[model samples]
Target: MYLLSKALIFPPVTEADDDGLLAIGGDLSVERLILAYNSGIFPWFNQGEPIIWYSPSQRMVLFPNELKISKSMRQIIRKGTFSITFNRHFKEVISNCKQMYRPGQGGTWITDEMEQAYIELHKKGIAKSVEVWQNNSLVGGLYGIDLGHVFCGESMFSKVSNASKMAFIYLVQKLEKENYKLIDCQVYNNHLASLGAKEISRDSFINYLNKV
Candidate 1:
């Protein structure tokens, strides 16, 4: 693994391990974080662990045109069961994401430092959030980096049964209307697969980021 220094540089994605861990020991400065996303790399490490960068050989992504909304989700959206807003409550959304429990995960990868870093990114308009509300109360939301034509999704959380899905669907429809090219999911999971997110070659994903 590469040990990053003051220089904001990263080893090639090809150098990543079988599990997609590319490098370690980089600080989460704004400059480094921006550069990382632009180059198809992202940091994912639990608290007490040195910041770890990854560029998986297979990247999970959702092209706006391919977003899948099931009948149940469509019905929920049409009913306006939840209200959606953009960049309205980023800190709250991320903080909730940090506290959310994930299956097979012992703790959050959104460390305190990571939270502060992304919060700063949000202030700069590089990071954005989608909030889902019910009965005037915040229920679910998601946060990610916005690369103009592509959104690099970091994490999401749900307090209700379909709150997170509502946030995601709303975000996808909005992005589609805005002519976005893709949503970078970072990794594959059944949750995303059901939404039509699929894996693509890292090289192909990088090329898309470069072009858009």
Candidate 2:
């Protein structure tokens, strides 16, 4: 699944074309990208390439009420050593996300182009961010799109232990306070599962989207 998702397939996607692939060679213009987010598609190509779109068979998501802040994480939160804020230095957040060293990972798909495109989205207020600071330095952050009540999470990174978890915890709490219904996490992986994100079949996910 990751292999297929990591490459441009044969056919390009049509506008709001949720079928197989969405436009393979499109630019990540704020207009196109925002449209994609609203329609459950997103660009995920590497550096020095035209944007490509994806609509997976299942969507991984977490309900605001479903966030599982583990006991250790709860302890971390109680420590109160980290400060979090919204829409703060979004480009810096993306850059910091790209630099994270994932164990057994070869490259980051965040890309220079995607970073700049999201920066433009941030400028347009279509994208929002959550940043975590520790000891006067950025230690964690995440960026995503806001479509009315649904927030489509793009990506996140942490420079310190438990930092990204802290950001996710805060996001769930904030959304719960605001009455937001869903955080569309986009795909399934072990990391997200541990944080309470779960897989819904594509049909069920789209049905949830309809509700949102």
Candidate 3:
């Protein structure tokens, strides 16, 4: 893998390792982050590790039209059990994502530096947050980078059952209305697959990104 330097650049995605680890040791500057997302690359490193960039051979993505909402989730949505808002309390949303415990994970990848960098991106209108509220409390939410027609989803958190799912559903619907073509899930997991996210060849994903 390439080792980054002061230069704000990345190796070609084609050069990434089999697991998609392209490079390491870059600062999360706003310029670099923007370039990275635009090029279909993103940083996903654990705390205490050098920033690692990846561009998988297979990309997990959700086309707006392919979103799946189960009957129960639809019932909950129809009941208006949760209220959704966009770009509100982005810091809070990301912080919660950082702290929320994962079922089999011991720590979060959203380190303080990453949080601050993304927050700055938010301020510049390149990042966004979707907040899910129940009884006026921020029970669930998610954050991501908005690349015009493509959204690179970063992380999500839920404090109540199906709260995060609700946030995701609402976000997908909203993006559909805005004619967004894709939501980049970065990697595959059963949770996202259930929501209609599918794996596409990385080259295909890059083609989509190039169009946007």
TM-score for every candidate vs. truth? 0.98, 0.86, 0.99
Pairs with backbone N, CA or C atoms under 3 Å apart (clashes), candidate 1: none
lDDT of 1 at 31: 93
lDDT for each residue of candidate 3 in 61-110, tens digit (9 for 90 to 100): 99999999999988998899999999989999999999999988879999
Residue 75 displacement in candidate 1 (angstroms): 1.0
Off by over 4 Å in 2: 1-22
Ranking by lDDT: 3, 1, 2
TM-score, predicted candidate 2 vs. hidden true structure: 0.86
Q: How much lDDT does candidate 1 score?
A: 0.94
RMSD of 2: 4.9
CA lDDT scores, all candidates in order: 0.94, 0.78, 0.95
lDDT of 2 by residue, 1-52 (tens): 1222333232322333444444567566777777667666777777766656
Worst 10 residues of 1 by lDDT: 1-10
Which sequence of candidate numbers ranks them by TM-score, best first? 3, 1, 2
